[model samples]
Target: MKTLVISSSPREDGNSHVLAQSAIDGTVRAGHDAEHVFLGDYVERMLGNCRHCRRSSDGLCSLDDRYETLLLEKMLPADGIVFAMPLYFYGMPARLKTVFDRLFCYTANSAPQQDQVINGIMNKKVGVVISCEESYLGATQGVIAQFQELTRYLNQDLVGVVVGNANSRGEIVNDPTDPVSAAANLGERLYTSRVTDYRLDTARSNKVWDCSPVGCPDR
Candidate 1:
């Protein structure tokens, strides 16, 4: 099985990244191949919120950006998806949100409300690893609420939601069975439920929108 772990922290060695990498290592230890993707690696190449929704008709994004490869190669085919996010203003980072926003393309061909279209994540399971500075109970759940809604909309199965408490690098190591280990376990646990069809329409790579209205780079 292939597990794709998405590290959303801007810093390469940030706590979130470390935990994500650890999860990947655990996934490998459990007899599976995994990929640890750093969002910072492609953030600059991404033009978030293109506002075109052209994929709805053309079966492809309107604007040409990094999202095509990111979605096609890593996201669509993966049996399991892990989102390692660092808390910002008690919520997910903007870059991760940008990635999530682009996912609207998955359901582009169907009506916004629901003319009946089953696409996107299908039966894939989603795992969330949250890193927060505050130890308050609501800190992590606050973000989980948003992700829960998104998973429901995408028709994804949210298998796990783990929270890591730390601000500095490597601090997550203190807890022997905390998020770090949980994340690693999640890598293999998702295999309990699998989707038979793992291919999606990812051939098109054209962006056909003029999204200067939101003005989020690449304008």
Candidate 2:
């Protein structure tokens, strides 16, 4: 199994990235190959929203950008994905969101949503590693719901979420058996689960569309 870890934290060696590194280590320990790409180091251009143009679902962006082509190629080949980041104002960082937006454009245009036919494609499993200034008890559930929705759209299984209590680089190492370790364990579990069992363990929680226009018909 090939695992790809995406570290989207703004900090060069932030706690979130540490968790991502742990996951990579765990993947290797489980006899699976793992690679990581730090989005902060990449020169990715901000992706524009879909224009609803005459675009085809072939995983190719109509516009030329710094990282779009490369990222699309990576997305097509990876078997598993790990998204690691720190929550910024209850949302993802602008760069990470832009990457997601560009990917959305590649997947669909308007009206009905369908799968894209990329040259190298596979149904992959996805997991998230998070680091926050505060504990995981507060508004973190919202983030989990967002990732769950994203995993559903990508047709990937969400193994679990790992949260670390730190705001600086390498701070996650303080807690040896905390979310960082859990992140590593999650990676090992992912490698084993990929071959032994493949099931979507959807967490029963809040409805993502609860605050959407449809969910709030009163609007």
Candidate 3:
């Protein structure tokens, strides 16, 4: 199996990137091919102006940029994907969100290859790694909810999530949680695990989206 590890941190060798590398190492150890890419490298060509453009006859995005190359050549072809990034405003970094937004072009399109593109995106194994400064219980909730909903919508299996607490670059190396090992384990599980259900496991007493005046009363 081929797995793609994407690091969205602008700083090279930052905490998030380090974890991404560890995930790649795990994938390799599991006898799978792993490719790592820095999402910041594609920031300049990211989707923005294409939002208003009408879909072409081929049902492709109007903007002609390398995102197509990244999606078709790297993302779609991979059997599994690991998204690693630092928390920004308690959510995903803007660059990573942009990539997800661009995927909208593939939806509800009539192109002959649309089915292929959609199928490539759906029902894949996925993993997540997040590095945040705060170790508080809710520090990573926003981003976690986002990924959970996204994978659920795409019919993908979210194998595991590893959150590292690191405020400074490379600080994750000293994190007591040992997120590096956890990330590696997540990567290995990405291939070995099977998808019994695509739904988000929300049976917990305190579900994040449970917005009520009193908050989960059961909790």
Best by TM-score: 3
Candidates sorted by TM-score, best first: 3, 2, 1
Model 1, span 149-214: residue lDDT tens: 887777788877778888887787675558777777766566653333234865543543435557
Stretches of candidate 1 exceeding 4 Å from the true structure: 45-64, 110-120, 175-177, 193-219
**What is the lDDT, from 0 to 100, of the residue 174 in candidate 3?**
96
The models' CA-based lDDT, in order, is 0.72, 0.71, 0.82
Q: Please write out the lDDT profile of model 3 over residues 129-213, one tens digit for every residue.
A: 9999999969898788889899999988888889999987898989998999999988877877644452486454543445676
lDDT of 2 by residue, 99-160 (tens): 66666555554423234423233367777888877765775777788877776766567877
lDDT of 1 at 45: 40
- Candidate 3 yields a Cα-based lDDT of 0.82
Candidate 1, residue 196: Cα displacement in angstroms equals 19
Better of 2 and 3 by TM-score: 3
Q: TM-scores of all models?
A: 0.74, 0.74, 0.83
Model 3, residue 32: C-alpha shift (Å) = 0.6
- Candidate 2 displacement at residue 49 in angstroms: 5.1
Sliding window of 10 residues with minimal summed lDDT for model 3:
202-211
**Cα lDDT over the full model 2:** 0.71
